[model samples]
Target: MIIDIIGDIHGYADKLIGLLTQLGYQHNGQCFMPPKGHRALFIGDLIDRGPQQIKTLDIVFAMLDADVADAVMGNHEYNALAFATLDPEHAENYLREHNETHTRQHEAFLAEVPFGSERHHYWLKRFCEIPLWLETDSACFVHACWDVDSMAILKPLLTRDNCLTPQALTLTSKKHTPMFDALERVLKGVETPLPKGIVMVDKEGTTRSRVRVRWWLDDLDNRPIREIARAPHSAIAQIPLDTKAEPIDFTLKTDKPIFVGHYWLTGTPTPLSTQVVCTDYSAAVDSGYLTCYQLDTECPLPLSPNNFVQYRHT
Candidate 1:
């Protein structure tokens, strides 16, 4: 089967359209129809830090509803859902993070997402249960980085978890709350803070954002600088290299293809062992283009968000 995996969209629906065209994904109205058995998968971060957030939601939700695509949640989406309880000021600020001119638009989008009936539900429902690791006997897909044996531990979790049903695992085993509940809190004006000692760091080791990105550390994906340098792009910024605690060690359990994202890849699309792959080119920011890859064919095509078309007006 030809599996098409897409990296972070970050509200760039128009840009995604261009990439879809290049990837040969045909369209019907606002929905898309992939070639038979040519399914699509998303690496999440479906909202925030960009314009047209709702449009992004509309397209992905439509595609998934149409059974043309599958998706996994990203940190941003997690934050959005979490902010749903952060009172008015925080909620407004969260909306402002992406320069959302219409808060109601965001409100509507969040309301439409299906978080599902699962207890112990840490992670969003719709895409959250898609499994951190996807594996066919011949392939696998993960969103972030891993080491020599990271895939080994992942296969069982995915298989035992059965990411196929998506809804099959109501309460995600990730030891966290689902995005739906968290977002409800934000909209309700609840205060949610970053993890302890996770103060953002800069080149000179200074704090930057109010929040942090260290979930992988708890997921057993951490390593010391000495150990990390062995991996490709270990020194890449936004990688959260300098942390006190670390995550558990992992191993690749299968000889299948693993498509993943989360880390912003700049130069080349490095494959760990012909089975592991990353698609995130950090599309939502000023850094570079969004990316998508065909699992069966193994092709990466870069895309450009077309907000520039409206830049002159702003």
Candidate 2:
């Protein structure tokens, strides 16, 4: 079977439609139909941070209903579920705090689907339906890093199809728990604390003491911080790692090729490593693109740069 691995859309419906058409999908009266023998696998983050939040979901929902596409739950989607769910112990609070930062980050989605509205509830259910990760015989697809340990921890907690259950959600919602940390790594990628007293301003303008690292790379001890971390700013990316910083002992252990999104990668779309490819290209920004990696299951391995398809901005 052939699969097109799509990246984080972040509510760019026009780019999604454009990328679909570029991939040879036809727009029938109902929805976009995949090319013969091809299916689209979205890496998620379908809502928030851009215009046309509901419209983006409408297209994805239509494709899913038609069985032409499948999706994994992005960090944003999981956050939405938490925001909508009330904490059973505290009737006044939600699983996700309604703080200024979270509200600002999620305001676009909440604006379109107001709290307690039927539409809001509808999307929340859909979010739960999206699996945390998808695995086929030849490859794996997830929103972020696909850690073996984290997957093992979450396997029994998730449903047979790998979607989240209400109990699983509640269990994973409690901060600082093993389950919570596992979920965070899977959805948001692996992060390592920077050297003491060192901080970096992220693309979102938030100061972060910990930086997301490329989990697929091994022997990072020899690599510079610019090569090991996903710091968006060049100045921050160049900082030397302090000797006191903890070493990253984990690395990708899978033989199967993995496809992931969530990192706002820039430049020409390419394979992150021989065993993995990141499809996200910062599509939510004005100059960014929506990307897809064309994969043929019959010969899936050692992903190449030639198969990347980027949305052409007209």
Candidate 3:
């Protein structure tokens, strides 16, 4: 089968339409359908961070309903569910606290869906239906890191379709639990603690003590922090190489290709490794592009830059 593994749309409908058209998918009044029996595999984050959130949802859900696409839930979708769901234990509070930080992160989505509208609740339920990962004989797909240990821990908790059950969702929301940790690693990727007393401001201007690591690489402990980090800022390079942080051992070697999105990578799209490809190019940003990897079951999994198709947001 020919699968177009697409990255985070983040509510960019025009770009999504353009990319679909570029990939030879024609809108048949209700949903977009690809020629030549191609299918789109979305790596979630369908809402938030851009204009036209409802339109984005309309297109993606239409495709899904039409059996033209499959998807895994992204962190943004998970967060939306948490923010809207009330805590069973503490009935007054939500699963995710509605503070300034969380609100800011969700503002774009709320602007379109509102807080407690029917549309918001409807999408929340739809988010729950999305699986956390996908696997086939030829390849694997996840929104972020595919840590073997985390997947093992999560497998029993998921439904037959690989989605989190209501019970699993409640359990995973608690901090410092095994379920929480596993969910974090899969949806958000692995992070390493910065050198003692070191802190860096992220792109969002939030000071963070941990830095996102390139968990797919081997020998991460021996590598310098700057080289293995997914988005190493200038301030991080200044941290001494001998800072003595233990390497996180999350790499899962596999023969099949793995595709993921959520890192918000920039520049020309390319494979992260021979077996791993990241299609996200920060599509919600002004200079970002909605990226997709064209995969053919007949071909080997090692991706080429030529297979990447994108529609840059002007």
Q: Which residue segments of model 3 deviate by more than 4 Å?
A: 232-238, 241-244
Best by TM-score: 3
lDDT of 2 at 299: 96
Predicted structure 2, TM vs. truth:
0.95
Ten-residue segment with the worst summed lDDT in candidate 3?
Answer: 232-241
* Candidate numbers, best TM-score first, in rank order: 3, 2, 1
Candidate that would win on lDDT: 2
TM-score of each: 0.56, 0.95, 0.96
Instruction: Name the weakest run of 10 consecutive residues (lDDT summed) in model 1.
Output: 305-314
lDDT of prediction 1 = 0.49
List, residue by residue over 1-314, the lDDT tens digit for candidate 1. 76778887777777777777766778898687887768888876676556766567778888988878877656555444433322343344432234343343355344444223242132244444444444455455555543324333333434465342322122222224443233222111111232354434533344433322222222324444323322233233433546423333233344445565665556555553334455777676665677776655443222223111111010
- lDDT (CA) per prediction: 0.49, 0.88, 0.87
Error of 1 at 30 (Å): 3.9
Q: What is the Cα-based lDDT of residue 44 in candidate 2?
A: 82
